[model samples]
Target chain A: MADGVAAHSERKKTGNVVEIGFTGDDAALVRALENGHPGAPAALFDRHAPHVRRMLVRLLGHDQELADLLHEVFARALKNIAQLREPARLRQWLVGVAVHTARGHIRARTRRRWLRLASDETMPEPAAPGIDPAAVEAMRCTYAVLQKLPADQRIAFALRFIAGLELKDVAEAAGVSLATIKRRLARAEKRFVALARREPPLEPWLAASTRWRDLRDDDDGGDGGEAAR
Target chain B: MTGGLQALGRVAGETAEAVAEPRAEREIAAARERLVGAREGTVALGRELATSQDQLLAYPGDDTLARARQRLLAGRRRAAGLPGFVRLAVPLAVCLLIAVAIIFGLRAREPQRAATATAVSYLVGTRAGTLGERVSAFAPRLGAAPAPELRFSDGSTVDLERASSARVTALDARGAEVDLERGAARVFVNPRRITRWTLHAGPFTVHVVGTRFRLAWDASTKRFSLQMTKGKVRVEGPTIGERQLVAGQRLDVDLSQRVSRAQTAAAKAQPSARPLAAQGASGRRHRRPVRPARQRLARTTRARRFERVEPMPAATPAPAPATATPAPAPAPARPTTLARALQHVGAGRFCQANGLLDDKALSATLAKAPAKALLALGDAARYCSAQQRARTIYLALWRRFARSPSAAAAALALARLSHTKGASALQLQQAERWLQRVSAANGASAAQQRIAAARRVELAFARRQTRRACALAREFLARWSAGSAARYVKQVAVRCKLTPERKRR
Candidate 1:
């Protein structure tokens, strides 16, 4: 009975801290952000910046330019903060902004390749220390294949699976309907698997599993609902 | 009993519901794990598959977050500071630039247009387009080394040698007319079923359907020349009138001298026969031994008769003495041995002609016989069905007077005899070699050259060398589209499926 009281007290303390930080809720935080409250940018950054950075790294595959891309995403989100339709969905809106920034960079990089002004040698190396060399090499191979995919499909794939976003969140981030995101993911999954099968380092990752095999048999129904959950 | 059964049923229903709920929850959890990876348990294989991508997770350092915050605030400030119109106009300009780039990119993928048929032929080969970007009939094109070649749609080509200038005078789908303005050009006309090509140089015009030849015209000298290496062509000009030339023949015309000469290799090899027409201007200084008065009278009569039979004018056999009296009967009462033989042959009495030509007395003087007499004696023997005798006579003519103008005719006769239907393979090979000699022999007459070229095609077809036969047939048809042998050559080309042009529908 004492242990239960202590757990309840700890939960109450966490709730109080959340209430104190934004002064009320996410709606209040969005208002403060829109009004350019002196503390609002720092508060938003502290809350969502890490999430956005993780999304970018997953999408672009450990690029050295990850920091710059992160900055671009936040800058766009703040500049277009007025365009956010729902104040309560600020985090979701920020995710959408990050997807847009990644897509733009992808398109710009493709253009540079077409113009022969840039090449594979110019791609930045993974900057994070303490990463396994094999993992880094696999990440390099994954991005190389990803670069060959269309921008919309690449973003959808990255958001849905790599970043572990729920199906609806992926749809919202890509500015597409939930059904469209599902279709994009299906195609991206097949294509990515087909391409990844060619890479020796990525082979083990795509190895068949009992759960995945069972899911594939009954994949038609409830996949979106389950993924969303 | 009924109440007890109802209670049991309720208990079973409750038990069934209890058993199904956790299983459904476990399945849902597994599905979630499949998509988002296992959050709190041992990693599933599905999540492990993305080992590389899963490892890509990174959190921004404090410094990165600070810079990003500053950048966001600064952007917000910049947006607030900007006037509304400037902000809208900047994006609009960027969109316009993108639109322009898209338009250019689409245009770049389009193919270049081909030149029109009015061009007659276009420049092609190594130096294509160097003669200007366009080609039109009647437009003189000058070319030198590294000169652009003119190519017709039908696959004909004219390679202009250095310092040469030529122009297309007329054009159509079937063939074209080219005028060699100055210098030299090597022309190749693709033989089509209905070709009608013409090449003009100065006052001379060579009509060709398909052929390969070199044509040159010198404006200052008023001279025109054509050397045929393949096929046949009809050349019309001053002095030459209309003459059919074939592969291995060369024709040179001098307007100032009112002279035109066609020759072949055999004729060129003859030192004495080379300058017969050229020496006409030098008159009587080089006149030979005077014949007896009676012999001179008989020679003049025979020359008159031979003139009617021979196509090309031959040199006066032996000039008549100035003091010789004219014969009243106009017949050779006691003609020389050669004159007697020629008369019999001209009258179709081949047996009588052969008998006289094969006489022991004639054999002693055969070494000194003129090329004309030797050629006439071979013809008489051939017509009399004296194969061995004719072969012997022709060989003698070719050997003793290898450089004589008539030697080409002798070689042609040998080729024909060897190419006969009953001849062996060895004979056919011999015939082909003879024809090659006739074609390559310098100063050979045009008629003999034509006969030799046509004979070669026949020999090749007979030997079942289909490719060579078709090639030679195409060449023959190019030069002699309306020639007597054209029908035969065209048939060969059609049979071989190597006709230069596609068959007309």
Candidate 2:
């Protein structure tokens, strides 16, 4: 039985693990990269690249754009790996990079729109295949709503709700004060809830969702019934 | 509930029907797995980058660190410039800088300051209006300039001019400390950090750690009043002689003469009774202290009394004892004013609710009732043209119940009103100011969220991004259609051209 297990593991290694160079702990990988071990960096990239790409895809709503951005993120990460003080935090470091890359893309896109001739047509919807149609539609709606928010608030909302990063992580990644992040998050959530409530078809979803309802209820109670809907 | 369940079931059925084929299910599962993998990868990367940034930021003055810092800052700037990015970036940045700064800066500075052999001395004074050229000369000496005109989150101000010769040690995230050599200096501790504003007066060291507390240290008489408006403070050393100050209490550290027994007795007496006496001396009626558990019961009673339902005259004719009183008419089934007010508000009859509140009568009634009732009334009167009345109620509430949730609510409302007619920039500024106050008092998450949303609206408006503002306005309206501020949302929507009638759905 031991022989059989060993044989199976060896075969698996031959097929998958051999494609990349050395595979071990994250620290080992970092050490390898430090030593300029061939293909060692690629192994690290293989482990983390897909996740970064997905984040970009979700944030930008375009796979091709995400793919391009993913390449840049890896290249930058690889170049700066030696400078990474804590190899253990490589994941957070990469995500932060992805967030910034996504932001740059969005900014460039917005700037381009401003430079071009004005069009009456609405934003073009992205094609997402084989996903839950409702979830995709909701995301699209959310994206449209997000475009209406100020840049700071939108980023805060994305980091907090969409990305589900902790308040501390979000603040650190964004390089703002905790208070500023709090202020932005507070406003963004309020605006998001308010906007979500205003959409006719989306109203039920907002009201029915416990999270949404709680946000509305909290805001309503605090403001002395001033803006409660 | 059954209907809701049925609707849910139908939706689920439709979703299932759409993916009936095994091939479709397999495809969906694969797609979902891929998405999950992707999401995990993104999160991992984000975490890794954040960690790396943290490590870099934590490095002890690494020159290469500046490049990483600039990258992070650039990313922040870009994110800040992106619509709806504040939610993600603001907190991340804030926590990174302030929290880390507070933790590390305090640790690094504490030992250095404590080890210093010479006390740095300078003159401290306040200047009104612009902080002029002389300001730079005076800046090093002044520990903290608390302008009375400048209201901070802590609700107290320090008059720097009052303490002319105070020495400053260090200024970090926690706040500044001063070595008080002569005369009295008053310091109000802000709530953001657990700041120990230590005033090292001769023979007396007063430490104010949190909230709106005033510490006055006098050199000649050696008298200090640590008046705690909110939160608590602990005073130690020979000057205080083992005394602690709680909220709404004042500890007078008097050393003019030998420590008198009478003053000690007065200080030891029930703290709340002093406020009661002050209230009585001002010709205001006082109510018996209801049990704290029954505090809500008192509010309900006061709310009922405000309704003014006429009591039935005593039974004139004597019938059988049990039947004569007519079962006391079940206490006349008085309708609670809060319920009535809420009803009127729900029906869009804000004017009626305002009328019921009788803003004029509130001053006398509020003096006797719990501050919460007045706060509620002020909130109700916000929509009415009675701005003065609303302002009065809020101010009174703030003064009487400064630390209460109601006070914060009133302050926020008043601040909002003050900003309404101002320019967009002014409004944004005011909103930011109010948000700071709200955040300090540990505001409700919902209130914070609304502030966030309003900020976005204000930001978009300021940038002349009318289309984006309109879109946001529409979302706000949709989410808060039944919210109390729905009308305000509607108004903003109309202004932004987000109204359904103005733009195609």
Candidate 3:
């Protein structure tokens, strides 16, 4: 890992010296890619995959989906490398691709709901209750309440609170005014608080219940220290 | 409520104590360790995916690469066979042929359609910003207002005043009925068609073929009033009244009461023989005879009733013009800059006004303006353009502001710009780095989301896994379908074979 990081840094430096503007190295990578250099694409993938994977995990709410998506993102990036205009902004470009791909995923899910209303799977139950039941319940309630908000508000709230992004970043990502983001967050917070109060603490109870204990016992190894904690 | 508040207070206090108390330091450390473990797990998984992508791409003589190369070669061959001249000409010729075919096809089919089918007409003008426009856009249109006494070809008459935001959905041989919601409208139906006309508002229904009556409903009040202006109307069902309202008469249908009241107030309000004109029918003839005496009595009664209502206070006269310096009278309109033009555009109330301006407007708006305002307007235009899927506008904005020192705003815009087609992967990576820099510098909230969303799209394409691609596409679509990125979401979904489904509550 250290060697990979060093090599990546060295490539970045060499690439940076070759070009003058913001995406100098990226441009060189594109040129190298066009010339069929072996390391150009690998370096690009290594640099950006982590950020993209983090985003996918947060977005899809599942590890398996994120893993699958991360692979696809890089492969498509390599295949379409020749089409890239600015190599320096490759990370952003990849991110854009992920966003587009994720959007398609969401749209398809929405359409499938009508055909398979009962078949749609619920979120997976957490394996063990290491975290406080109340906190877990809070998180579940937060997600449920968030689902009720308008798309823009939900995006802003998620970006702001769950992902812990700054106001300006949220605004930019949402492509709205700071004022608008503020407004959405305010409204979302109000609705979330109201919903949290009104809904019973079902998730908390479930987490604390004996069924959860048994499930944890079955899933964990014979030693139950981690499961109990 | 108090109990709930106390519980919340206790929870907050506990959390605070957990964080600040020295005794809990070990617990906090343990929690941090757990969090680090989680992060490390995620990082390891990400590394594995990255390594796999690298290996796949690096495979010697990979079948996927070979296939893609073959496809490209075939595409090139196909392109070469068509001479440049023919290549251009064929597309033009095909387009012209298709256009002609469509025109002729429509023309040939036109005559077979029914002649009296009325095209859907919008009665409430949409103004976008105003309450009326918002209401009309958000709320469903009820049925059309019925003429005072003239029955439509479909034999339905509606009360115009009680038919606020109503529309005529169907007018055919079966007769017509007015669908109304909140607001008041009066309808006058031809007596001959009385049995065929109907009035519907919320849960209440009134059947009439020939009647001149007013229907008023206040959604807030939950009260419905139906007053006859001419002819007669019979109430049935929930409202069981067999009263006939003559000329200069009124009837009130209390849907909640199941009892309607007949009053002679109509006669006391109208003195003239003039009748209210039906909406959207400039030259339609009145179907009911005018009774002048009863109308006169109705007018006097209405005048007296109006007198009893409180009069609006008169506006106070403006302070006497300053003797020394009268405010300059407004100057005649003058040619304006892009900013001024934007203001005008704003006034026009187009949803995509900022996006509609030419590059000249952008430069002009930015010139001499504060950086913050310029950035705000640019951001707004970027969003507006994104919503409209105006690629040219986004490109223009990027070219103008990509490297500016506006920090968060410029970097975010650049990231979006670099993500578009025709941009190289290297450029996109740099854009992502810039976004990360911005996030680190200013802690912008949307950067992570934007980065995440973009990454998901990239990964899906890289893997060529249709199911995974579809799933990610749906997630993004659900979040952005109502935002400025809806069009991009649609494009991605179409490419990925993911159809967005409407969210069910």
Best by DockQ: 1
Once fitted onto the true fold, the runs of candidate 3 whose alpha carbons sit more than 4 angstroms away are A1-42, A75-89, A114-121, A125-138, A175-180, A199-229, B1-505
lDDT assessment of candidate 1: 0.60
Candidate 1 displacement at residue B78 in angstroms: 14
Question: Which has the higher TM-score value, candidate number 2 or candidate number 3?
Answer: 2
Candidate 2: where are CA atoms >4 Å away? A1-20, A117-130, A210-229, B1-505
Question: What are the fnat scores of the candidates, in the order listed?
Answer: 0.20, 0.00, 0.00
C-alpha lDDT of candidate 2 relative to the true structure: 0.48
- Model 3 deviation from the true structure expressed as Cα RMSD, one decimal place: 35.9
Estimate the TM-score for candidate 3: 0.27
lDDT of 3: 0.43
**DockQ of each candidate relative to the true complex:** 0.12, 0.02, 0.01
Off by over 4 Å in 1: A1-46, A113-138, A208-229, B1-62, B75-224, B227-505
lDDT of 2 by residue, B1-505 (tens): 2232233223322223223332445443443343334332212222222222222222344232233333332332212223355446556766788988899988897756644523322233333222111211122234753422222222334443233334544333344445544433345666543344545544344566765654444443334455566776666433223356667666553332212111333454665423222222122233434444234333333333322221110001101111121221111123355445544443334456577655444545456545545555565566454667777877787677775566666656666555442236765666556544554444324543454454445446545567776777677666666442344445555556622332241
- Local accuracy of candidate 3 as per-residue lDDT tens digits, A184-216: 766654444444445565333224434333433
Ranking by lDDT: 1, 2, 3
